[model samples]
Target: MKLPIKIALFLMALLSVMAACTNKNASQRATQTNTDKRYSYEYVKKISVTQPKKALQVLQHAEEHKLMSPIDINILRSKVYYNSMLDYKKATFYAEAALNDSDINNRPEQLMSLLYLAALEYYNCGNYAKCLNMADRAITTGYKYDNRRLVGQVLTTMGQCHSEIGNVGHAINCFDRSIIIFKGEVKKSPNWNLYYALTTSNALKANAYLEMKQYKELFQMKPEYEGTLNKLNTLPEGISGVNDLANATFYSIYAIGYEEMGNHAQGSALYDKLIVTRAANTPEGATFVVPYLMLTKHYNEALSKVNEMESVWTRSGKDTIDYNYIHNILANKAKTLQAMGRYKESLETGIRAYDLNDSLNRRIKAQNALRVSEQLGKKMLKKHIERQETLLRINHIANIVIGALLVICIGLMIIGFRINKKLKAKNQAASTLVKELLLYKKQLMDHLAADEANNAKNNRKTLEANDDKQQQYDEFLRMEKMVIDRGLFLQPKLERSDVAKEMGISTSHFNELFARFSDQSFTNFINDLRMEHAAKLLKDKSNYTIEAIANECGVPIRQTFYRLFSKKFGMTPAEYRNVVADE
Candidate 1:
């Protein structure tokens, strides 16, 4: 459904308001905290390199000891994930928590925390529209304060979100702006944000151009194998941002560009290299596994890839909406089935892919809803506090006029006490609502876990069924081989009728035999065998070009050969041959 433009504008306005108010408070806190800076400055610098999980622990200790300001602790809490962990949800949680605190608004770190939370949430959820909104908010705040690094980072993140949602033109605009800041070295030299923003903008611009199918722009931007490899190499070793699974994604895109440019051999080879690099950096031998997904033809391999991605995200405490990674796997697996000539099975896979995508969208929107509720909760809390302060001031003023209206004043005091009691009840209710919101968050995570598990189970069952069918088909292939060896039929274009006649049966009866033995019609079996044989022959560098290979395999046209080879091999004939040769 199309989002109403008016609503989008309204949300943008609300975000602006939130940013303005938060920034005002942040500024005051920043002044107070930095005034006594000797201890905090050294402590903050020392903990910069700490792991996110460990940083959270340290921050918790600081909070307990009353050594850290709520502002400082919140900054640490949010940064623990945003800077160190890459866990978007926790980063968002702490950032939002920090923003909601009346004490932390307007500080540079608080502004950064809010921006980081919003950007990461949008990126992780695949909600480009909201992501862009948050990025705009962050950029606005950062620019107002001359925080160029935050501006650059938000611009790059906006570019990426635009790329993800197919907004090529807008994506490039963001990347261009980010590049300007990046070139100026506006951010601290050693700051990871600089490298991350530049590389992200570059990579995303490449992706945007690729999506547009504009090879010239893509190449002009230096989105090629050699260039990306150089950048990857130049990236500092053990830098968490540069060599992650996402970094390997650039290589994947480069390989894709090569494939699209009709250099499948190079593309396939690059793909192999990409998988190796990704697998190495990916913790626990578990990566996003997109490469394994693209290369392997087997359904089990696809299922395994999804399972591994899910496991890794779970272990890392990453958002479940990271399902895009797994959804891509599911979508590709359907393509693989189509390549394998399993059209019926492919349809089923496609359905599963659709379902998974739908589930992901729903979960993401739900998370966004939770964020909205959190913001609303904070607004209400502020209003309630302000009202209470107003009432206290009013009571103090009323006390001075208390002679004849003493009874009335006492009555007013009793009424105020009752109102306070109700306020207390209301606060308790609000706390319960917050608890429920957290529960909802956990429930959503659990649902994602369950969905993935069920999807894996379903895939395994389908694969087992396919395995059984393949076994039957293999038996039929063996029989066909024996018959061919014996020169059972003279016709070069042998049909099922001939096979049935030779086996002393009617065509219909023979079809039943074919179905029982091959799991598909005789025609599909024949075509699959012919294509498989042609693929094998094509792999022999000594034999033939694609056209000759096609002719020899009894597939008449070059286009048909290209189509069939790609369908059977998950790549073009040349790509398959090159991949085989490289192996």
Candidate 2:
């Protein structure tokens, strides 16, 4: 009887404890129901770099179910695209969309962060102007909000842009300011990004000195290689890829350690390990060991390293291939070859570098031309809209005045119609020009193979000395090949008359010879050559800007270049360059 009572009491006690725990869990669940799943962003961030598609699906699910607001969804989308997908333009779009959201209005820190992200993406897309504009907003917001770390981040990107655009002095200033901010802010609030920013600014400032050839100043900046690594080691393992980032950021800072202090083999080993991370693949992150190798008189090692570097570099995907960086590599190879007393190979490598550089310049020109035309188009549209609005207002006011104003209003309408008709005709004429240029461009582009086949046959043709007319015709053909090969037709004011004079013949004779020898007229032939040259320049972009490339191709800027270039390429020059840049 005593044992049964004890067992019953124990059972009752267990039931009471179980009921209390259930009520506690119920209370916790009720509490969680009221709060949004903002902490769920951690899962998204963790998986984004490796499983972007999955991360996107999660974001979509949260968004469609209204579990998260548009501001959260947009920012997450932007972060995913920016960090993982490597789509800067798309990232910028989402980031800006989030920035404009009303929910972001009350959140100063979030707004500043998104602005910085947008600015960074713009810089990635090579739109330094837009980047700077966005950076200005971010800097202002950060300063106002007293987010010193965020301000430092913005300055670093600004400095990078300045360095790229050849504003070395300004770049250094920005870097210095960023470094100061990072140093002070990190002390107050230590974090992964802040520490990394501090290190990056320091390296960049040193690199700026390297660019200016101020080696003494660079060397004076302490914490060479190992010290840089030690600084990086302060970052905790709580952050993903922190270890890789540290090693990559400090790469080759050891091999030379400013001037000289390490072995080429050791640097090579470090490079192989460091390059596994994408951080080291950037132009700024590349190994600076080749110079050190050369300094140590390791010519063979330098040459081998150059070859290896290029092989790995080209495999880094097309988007990562900076023309200037590639051109620099080639130039270095040329120098290394010359140092080894291989003059012929050095010359060949040097020529390749020059050709790449020239290509880069042409791409820059086309981009500029595209930008100018776009601006003009926007201005024209704005003015047209304004003029129509003005006309409507004037007509409305005139109707209230008198019947005499009716005739004037009608007259104004007639004038507007006539103006519209003229504009239409002008547009039609421009369209016709584009069509003709495309037709010629197509013909020339297709002729490369045929020209190569005919090349051998033309030189092999037997000349009959007894027939003066035949000899003169053959001589004209021979001289034409030389002229074309030497790119003499590239002169802006080149004319058939000039070519005839150079060929020691009259204009009539030159015309006759040209018609008999080729299917194209002088104008068509020259235009085709120019188009071909333009395409070549656009394609070989290694390290050039998007400027008015066809300016030097002897095409008129307003009438011919941009219109024809857009039609031929099926996209505006800037759009095409952006696509290539993205690739």
Candidate 3:
């Protein structure tokens, strides 16, 4: 009886302990839930443009405490940096982090936002192809989710990319589509976002028209642009909350349009407004350099104003200057200097601008090569998978065939496998050769730049010792040597017109240079290089046939090759080979 009573008391004590443990867990869970809610609210809703620094502190605190979703935090961080601080690199980093997060794989809305932001950052970086690719992805995702606003934004960005690349027609089409979508969204709900999109789209369209020299279209759009500007002004300050750089761009385009339409007074007034309203120390004010340039082209005090603006830009620090933007600034500065009769300074600035432009072009080409390689890799992977599936199917059929007709099937399969192996080996070798060729081409381009610079220096010394006519003759000789050294004549379709364009000289000038220097026409000069290369190849006892060597030397027809070789070298290709053998 005493044992049973002890067991009952022990059971009651055990149940009481269990109840206390459950209550503690419940309280802890409630506290965690409340903390999560608070963090989410503070990071996502309570944060404002005016309080980005404080918002960043809250974000850091939340991150420290491991509250809220990581993707959510990253997205917010990207927005804060992009919208408030205008730090595109940091913004892109966070946006890309959000994109690469596994947590957002199934969340289309979040993924779409990250993609659109990434596209914008790429556009800012001047990676137009990557920008277009990301914009396309975002547009597809947005359409799948039936999100019109996201689609409109991506389309607008796509338009900007096209505009940057000088695709005016495609740019106009994209802008129109985005404007239509934004108009529809506004019709449903009159929001500041939609209004901003509409205004920016129309402004970009006008800018495109300006680029295409469609003055009639630009004039037609002027009244509409004015009306939109008026409406935009009526909105509360920062209500649209769009990119201030873009806002400044819209105003600049408006002013440019007025100037193009011969309203110099109105254009001047608008320029004054832009200069005063957008402080020169700001990013938006960096765009003011455009108007100042235009003003300098027409007005008198513009040079002093541009100088002041340059001081402001320098004070803002070099980190604030974007690569492409600075290139434009230097170009405009050079032009302004020329207008002010500062020829030496203008020439130096122009050379700097040209060098920067060339660097940017080379970078763009390298990026394009990388992109193409990636796409080819994907295609090759897909083809490989398909080939594997096909081989498996073939193997299955071969097994069946072997059972039905053993002897015949065995022979057929052996032959088929051998052929397949040979083809694969050949393809692999071809691919490797192609890759090596691309590498060689890139190396050749680098060597070409260095050679051009060296040649320029040599020619400058030559010029110092020569008269103006003699200097021109020397320059032509240097250019001709460059063309021959690069083997440009090996291009079968290379023409005098093309070479003239490459040299940045008129066709008539090219002809005059050739006549004065070589005493031979351009055709004879090209033929001479081909004959020289052919002679060298023939002497080397290369495996190439006469016709093949001729083709390689840019003479396609065998008869024509013989005629040119006999005329230039005093013998046929075979006779040249015989003489080379005797030597």
Candidate 4:
């Protein structure tokens, strides 16, 4: 296993060069030093998801005062935009700058990671040529560094770019290579993420095979990926988006494959699984719902879903939404409306879809993108220093040694990237605590439903209340649990009538049942259900942002969710989560 003498000598000389450069430029690390580690990676990551503006401001301040090394500042900026803001253009810009900077150009591993980010952002922006170009460079960097993880990662993105452009053969080749690399790495160290990566590669490969109607390859994929998922299920807590990514990758293809094979029953069953998962909560996975809605003739829900998707993309957010996907959704809406015999409506929708298609083609072909001004940040950073009000925040930002920012950045490349979410990790699995909580929620609902049904009927009908005629109050509550079990409580406009219909009771009778038997009013009852679910969601460690949690709990307006949650639980959602974590 020894390297040839020339290769060995070259590696030694390379190390010597790197060491010399580190010593030479070590003093040139920071321009103006931060006395208080305010712009540290740890601090930025803490605020990145929930308070993106604050995180960005802190980063600007750090850069303004020369608080961090140049490379560190830009890298953090890239990741915050990429992961939190979902703004791909700014992410791509910063990532490209970081790679080209004198501080990071010699660091192969960091280069590998940054290259992947830039390529992913390009793909997001629908710049296929640029995406492929970045991926090619990333692949080369991965090989140069002998980083199997990076190589596998970039190949997955590369394959996706090909798949997007209809180059199925090339896509399949890239996917297969990525899968092989991932599988080999998994054998060395088994983890859910690696398995997830393998599953993603397989899923993309399966899609390509399905497109070509190569059922044989597709058939082989089912067992292998299912087995991979089984192994993943046994592993411990992963980073945010495991459940979502799993559904979007393996289960999505599984459903589509069943549909393609004409086994509508099996496909429908899998489709239901997606509805229960967090698939609809995300833009990428939300598209999967449309096909099932169309198949089931749930035209109204399908239209609502399309509009919701459109709103999500067009909202006052900096993130780039894929117009190509939006066009597809529009086309699906037109078809759904046609099926429902809404001829005039369908014609208007079809026109919109066609116009969007033309617009998308122009975008993809032209790939016009705004540049992130490198100078604006410098000016803003310096201007904001006099106004900086940071007193303390030690565990994260405080621990980042300000004077040793460059050295710290280098050390973090080994371990801090995982924490920064830039490093990704050795191979973490979904945490056991997260698994237990998820299972507890599902099992708790199912268990309580049966237990309460039996108790409501056999044990106690009324709680010795005044003016209580024999009401099915217990029964009303039981059926409400059914509504929540079906995730209907997450509906913002869900009315009392909706639950009454589900319960096979009259709306007036439903109101009386709550009025007589329950201490809280009907509205309070619904809010309580949402509040309890919000608590569970907060406890569940994942990428459930405050906004996402509010939306998930049938409260889209952040202020409303906060107000109702405070009334129900004495503390804000953020405080409640902290309390639980402390416990």
Candidate 5:
């Protein structure tokens, strides 16, 4: 009996020891899993900016093992999408998910980061209003979290949004605030964020001053910009990773300012420097494209450079072609061609630019629509959560109320569907009308060309019957030289009689001489000269508007100016101006 009792006790002791060991092993596994998850997250964060593809792979591994929480994984995915891939749509998706996640609602820093990322994506998409809204939320979140660096970053972004929308004063003010905040933050050590904020803010401020034509203020900030650049250069490359962008932006601004100030030589030199530096660092990307376009405006070999840019773009991959950059390049090419008096080529290039601009505008509108839908969804979600809480409190009545609400929602959805269908039909009709109008315009242009050719032939025949044809031609040449040399075609109300009196000839003789030698009447000849001058004036994009160009060309009636220009060029004055201005 004693032996059996001892055996039983030993078995009981063994069972207790085994249970203790199992519990300890389980605890150790949980701790190891948590540590692995933390290390994975850290690894991903470290590589997200420098090696995004690698970061993404690690994040996938973490996700597969359920190492990170859903909210954390979503945020990581957002960063990878945005910083690595430049995929704003996917970035926004993950960002929105992370923001809406209940686990992260109280995480102020995470919320602020998400908001800032969204704002940046919106800004890149040209949705300035939405960008501003996101920026404002980020600012609020920054203050709530007492994150000065975050506040400064969002303020700089706000300044950019304001500048985009033509609120230069507001933009400058925001930049100033951001600069002050960054200056304070940089008192400890070389903080890359603070340094970037300071330089970018100052750069933006200088740009605003330049835009407002406050050259003195812009020049005053020159030393500050240079000093900031020097400071940025001192930072390690890992910390100041956007060095190429910073350098390109600074030099480009100065180049533009110099050009605006009529120091083209200095501007051209700066642009050359920018281009060379960008080539070494950034190579064939957006930064390189800026100096390329700026140089196109100032250099004689613009067409060659443009062709090179196209080659670079092609090599960069067609999928990555920035529409805005393409549009700007084409527009610049058109301007350069017009300046070189290649009007036909300029006109064709200008039309392409217009089409691209229209497409880009439509894309921006769609992005804005998405932003608005996001806002609406947030509002609806809040209401939904409130209603859910109310339903839980009144469980007995909840079913009946929910049933009635469901029926109402179904009816409203049906009405919405019908309205959407009607809208679609109306939009299609409008689009068709636009197409028909375009077709009619094309046919009208063909008719005008035929009429112009026939009129030229008839006018030549009408003026062929002169007794002393050679002598008459010599006198006509003298009068033509006088009219051109004196710019007589610039007189808006000058009649044939006025021109004849100025030329010391009878009105009929003057008209006949022009018809014989110039293949047109005196009036038509003067209009031709005026149209040529108008086309040149249209190329000076900064110096004249369409109305101003018309006035300068002595065309008092704007409608008549359009009509005659269309007759002469096979395109309206606005269209011609669009082409010339694109150059």
Candidate 6:
């Protein structure tokens, strides 16, 4: 059953060539790095809904354009290649790419790249042991690297990997550690990662409790979990300007948690809310539609919504990631069709869902596989270091035993020592590079701080300017009060000459002075003062109807009430009164 040697070698040669073609330069890698920060999750989610070819093109564009940083790009490239395309070989390529260049001077970013690549490899191969091993490396590296949040994230991922592989005790341990870390740091902020991490840890904890039949404890966790979710919901909509995937995920998880706690009605309501929110925010034909998956039971309605969403996206050029939405709805449609005895239609819809799932699995696998491969590479490096040390010891022993060989060995040893010295120099050089990078990072941070300080100063100056303007308004008020003391604007049909007489000035000089001081014509100023007083009188609901208030304030025309009120307050007198009543 073995292939002939010639054919086998030829196939291997072809693969090697293909691999070489996909290897990218740093700029191309940089594009992926930037995109990773912004779009990695969206790409993964999109895999469930979009065609593999289209997803591949998206990754290619990022790579070709050099839109992201190298480490970020490698993480994303590995993920997109592995998960969406199911190209394990390319996934391995990018994971290794990420690992090789992951030294960011800052330990946190380096560990993050390592963590991503490790997880990608493990999940793709469905190798839970290796996944945990990689995740362990990430957790350990995070500890060594002093990034508590990354450590928590790794622990959560480790828990999920164990849960998948049926290692309940280990999963519980991982989840417990993750919860401790999250409680220590993640609770203080509204980070989306923190929310998801918390959800995963709680979900795992609840599952463990469920397994132990500790129903009371499981029930108790429900309210705390829901409270966390409520806090998440109330957070100011983030400035990211896209639908908040983390919030949507919270609702989805809460739906599960609530249903398990014997709150089916609440669970269903959450699901409905998730669906509505997603529909409103999601773009058409864009691949992120995880929220829509819950509505599978309502297949016809879901498909209609999907079509509507697709139409909107198409018209507006928006991307939609809804693979699960498509699969779940189509599956439901197939089942409904089958129940109605329409086997052919059922088969057709089922086939569509099946095909879509294949695409989804490919994308997930690609990203996961890269994660696993990166972990293995780190283990290999650790092993290589150990082996080198052992060899050096063996050579030292050999040199002592052979005296004639000792002289030549001593010279060789001197040369080897010199080479080691040079390598140390290179290591120092690397450290220098790291220092320079850190200094540059500090400069950028300082610049940002300075810019912010400048902005604050400018804002304060603007406030002072506004206060000056308000002071001018106050002066106008004082002048109006003096005129009021002399009984201007009191007549039922107030005239400018009456106002001038009240102030004891000629009409011409009175008009000029009033206009110069108040920045309004005398006639206009008098009418406005009358209107302002009339509006205040109208607000005294017990004493004054609109007509009575208008008469008392010396503006007797009832129709004028409508015009003046609308101009001054943006609503009619009746409407304003109704608004007050509601308040």
By TM-score, the best candidate is 5
**TM-score per model over all chains:** 0.50, 0.45, 0.51, 0.51, 0.52, 0.40
Model 2 segments beyond 4 Å from truth? 1-39, 50-54, 224-231, 253-583
lDDT per residue, candidate 3, 343-407, as tens digits?
99889988876676656655545545554556578776566457557856886898798787987
lDDT of 5 by residue, 1-583 (tens): 0111111111111111111111222343345446764435445654665576777887787779877667667877876666545555567678788878886665565677678777776665555666787888988877886878678777767776776678888988987897888788778646554576677667667767866878888888899888987797787643213555567666766776777788888887887777666432332233333333544454455566655655665564533324434444566667668877889999998887777666765565555455555667877656645754674568658768989999999999999999977755554454345346545644755665565466467755554653587658657756765666688899998787887899888999877887777766667878877876675566555466678888888997889899877676566666555444443
Residue 7 error for model 5, in Å?
82
Q: List the residue pairs that clash in candidate 5.
A: 334-583, 335-583
Error of 3 at 541 (Å): 78
lDDT of 6 by residue, 1-583 (tens): 0011111111111111111111122334344435453344344223422344555566666557765455655655565554334344566667766666735434355445456456645544444555676677776776775767667666656665665556767867887887788777654765644554565456556555555555577668877766655654565422221124434443554454466566778778877666555423443211223223422344454445445544553464421223323433455456556655668987997777767665654554455455545666767656645654685577678757677687888999999999977755554454345336545644755665565466467765665676655644443444465556554676766676775566565788655555656775666666666655654554455456778777776667888767865675555666555444443
Return the lDDT, model 2, position 42. 48
lDDT of 2 by residue, 492-579 (tens): 7788888887777799988878877778677767776776566556556645543456775777564576676666555555555544
Clash count list over all predictions: 10, 16, 0, 10, 2, 48
Q: Rate the local accuracy (lDDT) of all candidates.
A: 0.56, 0.61, 0.64, 0.64, 0.63, 0.53
Query: Which ten contiguous residues of candidate 2 have the minimum total lDDT?
Result: 1-10
Model 4 spans > 4 angstroms off: 1-73, 76-86, 282-285, 317-331, 338-583
Better of 4 and 6 by lDDT: 4
Q: In model 1, where do residues sit more than 4 Å from their true spots?
A: 1-52, 72-87, 186-193, 223-247, 276-303, 313-583
TM-score of 1: 0.50
Write candidate 4's Cα lDDT for 226-297 as tens digits.
Answer: 887677667662433343545544555567667768888988888777677664555534466666566567
Q: Which residue segments of model 6 deviate by more than 4 Å?
A: 1-69, 76-93, 102-108, 120-130, 168-173, 187-196, 203-219, 233-243, 256-264, 279-583
Clashing pairs for model 3 are none
